[model samples]
Target: MDLKIFSTLPILLLLYLLDCGSAQSPPPRGCESSLESVYFNLCDLNAVWGVVLEAIAAVGIVITLILIVVLLCIIPFIQDKRKKASVAIQWIFLNSTLGIFGLTFAFIIKFDQRTCPTRLFLWGVLFSISFSCLLAHAWRLQRLVRTGEGPSTCKMIGLVLVLTLVQVIIAVEYLVLTTVRLNNVCSYENKDFVMLLIYVMFLMALTFILSTFTFCGHYRKWKKHGAHIFVTMFFSIAIWVVWIVMFVRGNAELNKSPDWDDPTLSIALVANGWVFILFYILPELRHITCPAKKEDDPPENIASSQRNPGLKGVDNQVFFLEESNRGIALNFEDNLHSPSYRGPSPMGRNVYSSPQEFTIPRPHTRPSYHPTPLLQDPYLNYHNRQTTF
Candidate 1:
């Protein structure tokens, strides 16, 4: 009986192999009978997450373009050399962020050998570019706060590119090792993906820590920059935590590990890109592009932006108005309530409660006809001359 069963096992296995080979699975939803079935992961608008992410990334791309235009347009108007020096970093930062959004399209499409490696390689590159630019910016802020200046535009740009180069090398090595060496292009595990991003996480952590150092300096005006960086890094850290957990453990626990991988990464990309746009990039663009006020500006002819003698009195002067007609010197430093100053005149509202209007006294007049004895009215002088005659 055992020999007979063994002989029939070979035939049964062949039949099962043929049956399994003949059993064809249905195409992906919203993909059947479509001309774009080749790349239906993106073209399949019926896939809710793919459609939503595509729309979001499209919007982000448009907004980034508009901001780039605005940044370029405002560059000519930016008078401060420090701010002007920052333009290159800002441009690099914004374009990297745009790449982040644009790269989302790769993830939205179906995963193939080519798409997989492209996604893996570009993911760290774009993120590294953005974080390195941010690192340079935050470093500049700290330096500016401490020394009241920053490095030249060339030096800052070089620093950013150098920092980003490290990640590029790492990403290239990772891509080659995983795709070419191992011959596992699209089959790379989730852990492998996270491992490839370790350098990027290090950059992010460094950027987050460095951003806080802006407060250590004396200049508090730029402390708002620290706050902005802090918040952006904070939320980014949180988003990373959630996605890493889902990608590493939660998806497997829920029995959706392989299926959820694309959505997990796609969602993280979209969320973090928006965070960059909303938290860091928009605020930075607004700051660098704002119209300069006269008080904050140095004279046009002066070669040095530091020789701001005009700002010296801004802290001390409570009310200041410069008109060439009549010099009404209202020195309120002596007394807040000068006796001559009753109240503010009804012409306009006064900032201070008591107005310091200097009252000039009228010279004494002898009579309506003459004031000085020698220089009396012309008629009186003529009469006196007639008397003399």
Candidate 2:
């Protein structure tokens, strides 16, 4: 229908012709209509079904390639040094190994040529990179807790290197064992389930270990920084867990039904949506941990903030001094009287301009008021002192 599809038409026709030619030439040992169940082959593939499967797988392969390319293109431009390195290395692993090679092998490669060992090996490599990144994430958490610094490139690189090595070893062992056992193109069912079981157990163990460490780190953050980090970590881990669970359930259901209508795909679609939300949306949802940088703010903005010209509450000492200085003017007003004499004096009765205002004396720097004796007693020396004064 489209140019892309039209371009692929020739290749698809060639593949179909090759399949037909190979079928006509091949009649192995007792592999005939009798042993149909024992050796599963593409001879059972209906024309429509085969075409549809190829289209769907092709779409998947294209999407995976686009994601890899986008990641590769974006990671280099990230500004944060540590995050940039982590993202770069992570994109390299995802693009080159997990996305490109794995998708090509799983979806684009001819079904008859594809082997169980190859699928398992690719899966191991895929999960290994994912798990290693997760472990590095855990290690970063631990480092942050012990010392208040973020993750380093050394940490990420080391973990990725170790994980790649381990995955390669496991893949090689399975490859060797399968080649020995199958002695030809290997099908999915005839592969050793025990080796896969062991590998899965190892993966699960590592996942659990990393998860525990991450959880502990989250717990520590919750204790120290309230529940903000806890909520963020919850969303991150929850999304990934959902993805894993959906994948497992989907695979199991596909094994049983072999139909594309298995609910696992829906769950996987949901998980992917959540994963994007966790990575992109959740960070936007949460408040930034770091404060604004100096360069981000303007100098004029700082000056405006500094120039807050408004009156605040008066100080007690300043108010007291002002009140005291103003007290003498109001002391003899019409409604006022001395404390010792409640009855109004002649001076207090006048509300008009008082004589004190007409000829106001230079105000005394200090009041000359002194306390008088409480009573005139015979034993006291008050009489003699008064006479001398």
Candidate 3:
């Protein structure tokens, strides 16, 4: 019994020593500590990548603001006779730009109950508004070119509002559901949030189809606007595809940290916003601001025509000469007597009147005579006798 107790004592002492060694050692590093300790805030300036994203977001916001200002400044000078009707589209575009700017805020600020809702709601609604505007624009172009009829500006605005309202409904439903189930925590799994994008995807698809049809149908008449819509849609689709893949699939394998999701979204917002600006907004702005070239006449011809209204008659005469089958001589001296002439110009200038008085000759009138054969012979004989003498 004594020997057994002595052996058990050493085993117990060894166990105690092991426990002491573990307690003296530092705590094991947690996943949160390792990943989150590096970032002091949402956009940690200490990290290079975070700094890059923040800078990009900041610059994007600034550019978006500038675009808004430019749009406002150029509204009066748009030179489009339909500027009143088109103002809705411009305002929608500005709203979209503002949405893009808002999206960056989601990344720049730390995630919380408030910001989470903003990130989720604004992203869906703002994007919907923008693409809805595109859809409206494309639809209008299609109808105008195909049927020579279009909706009124108010109807167009209504259409856009209806389209965007659908998205608003979807977002609200999502937020409400999330709030009820998650105890008012705005946090959502990326996959679930992405699923909410189904409606957005639908809007995008519709925009693409409408834009493609518009582009194909009116390529001849509305080449610039059609191409702009087509290219912008195509570019947006590419960006969406790439970012969706990265955010949903690639991030799991490639992301070095768990906090990369916001950055990914922020990057996408900036890139997609710039794409819209570069492809759609910038081109439209340029088209709006720049004066269109007149293909009918040269600048000098236009200037001369404006300066001298009398030359218009000469042009008309030249056109008439070119059209006529028979050659017609124009007499400058008799031009004042011509049917086309007025007594004097409004400016009191005697354009083609001659100073000298002239008269036209008339044919003389005479009685007709009939002669018999004897008279004709006598006359001929007398003429012959005189000639012989």
Candidate 4:
């Protein structure tokens, strides 16, 4: 989940400052102002942020890749394979790779000092957003498994379909932009303006659409399940909103003469990357399993356990019959003991062992007599002699 989303904040600020530097008129040092613009004023600061962001993002990329490799390492060992888990893992890799590409391209944009690379920027954004969607899908899968049946399967399918359409549309736009740039129709200025508008609109539309679905799904699931889904959806929506809003505002600032001294836009983008990990990816890290407690065992069989609990049988009657046949008596040795048995099928009466079955053994009598204390008493000597006769 710690995918260097927040780690790139300083870099994002530096980039935003760079963008703003281009938009605004130079500082009023007049004719004496150095030929080197404010953009390059702190040559060291830009390079420092660049190196730091690159290093952090690179580390994140490496970590994410390592995590993916680790997951893949043991995938073959799963006795009964989970197709959903496999799908989730594949998406995780795609998400991480896309994220790495975005960070790399962001560095490229910074180092090159040009906004003409629309395709890279656009694809970077698309990949970043796609990562979020994939993460949410993984979360949904977990929720579905945990709660048995999730809220309307139809809704989940619909949301994924919409996201797929958005991705396809964005991909087509990327192709078109790439083609346009190839034909030389879009120069540095036109590409920046056109690409900015397109990117903002695309992101806004995506954010709004996704927000609708996320909220609806969360709301429906919340009512059925609990507050967990609501919190998750809220954070997810917040991330989208923050990104879209900052993107739009940044574009607006750019259009209004270009000297917007703000770092919100870069922060927003970096935040978008991290927020997905926080809200969606983090939740899928662990799965819900049945609780482990000794008291969770069935009341009837708690005492039968040897400190360590074990499942006896599914059917109580079967368990009782097996125990009785094996000569294990279920008597009221303590107040905690319940002589009463609650089997799957209710019996008409309580049965006890026969007294004759406890008689003393005799050479001329039954060989398998279960001797009792009464037969060993001195008072039973007369009876023993009588019986010998």
> Pick by TM-score: which candidate is best?
1
Model 4 clash pairs are 23-258, 23-259, 24-258, 24-259
> Which has the better TM-score: candidate 1, or candidate 4?
1
lDDT, residue 338, candidate 2: 37
Per-residue lDDT tens digits for candidate 2, residues 209-328, read: 544444443224312221323343445355545545545554555574334322233333233323433443234223222333455333345434446433223354456445544554
Regions of candidate 4 where Cα sits further than 4 Å from its true position: 1-43, 46-52, 76-101, 107-115, 118-125, 128-166, 174-233, 250-266, 278-283, 286-389
Off by over 4 Å in 3: 1-43, 147-149, 217-221, 255-257, 292-389
Put down candidate 1 lDDT per residue, 1-389, tens digits, no spaces.
Answer: 99999999999999999887666444566666534444666656567888788889999999999988998888888866777888888899889989989888888876876688788889999989888888888888888767667778888899988988998898888777766767886677788889889988998999999998988865555677667788889998999999999999999999997789889999999899899888987887777756555554333433243566666576333232222112222322222254543343442233334344443322234556342223322122322433443
Model 1 poorest ten-residue lDDT run? 320-329
Residues 1-389, candidate 4, lDDT per residue (tens digit)? 46697788889999999998886645433222354442342233433443444444555566556645655554554442222333443444346444633554343232232434444355445553554444345445444443323334345445545644565575556557756776652333423433544543554344434443343332232222123334444554576565455444655656732222123333434554554444433443322211223433432344355444534534654554455433322222221143442221222112223422332222222475443322222222333343444
Error of model 4, residue 373, in angstroms = 26
Candidate scoring better on lDDT of 1 and 4: 1
Report the alpha-carbon TM-score of model 1 versus the true structure: 0.68
What's the lDDT for candidate 4?
0.42
Compute each candidate's TM-score over C-alphas.
0.68, 0.43, 0.63, 0.43
What is the alpha-carbon lDDT of model 2 when measured against the actual structure?
0.45
Listed per candidate, the RMSD to the true structure in angstroms reads 14.5, 16.7, 14.3, 17.5
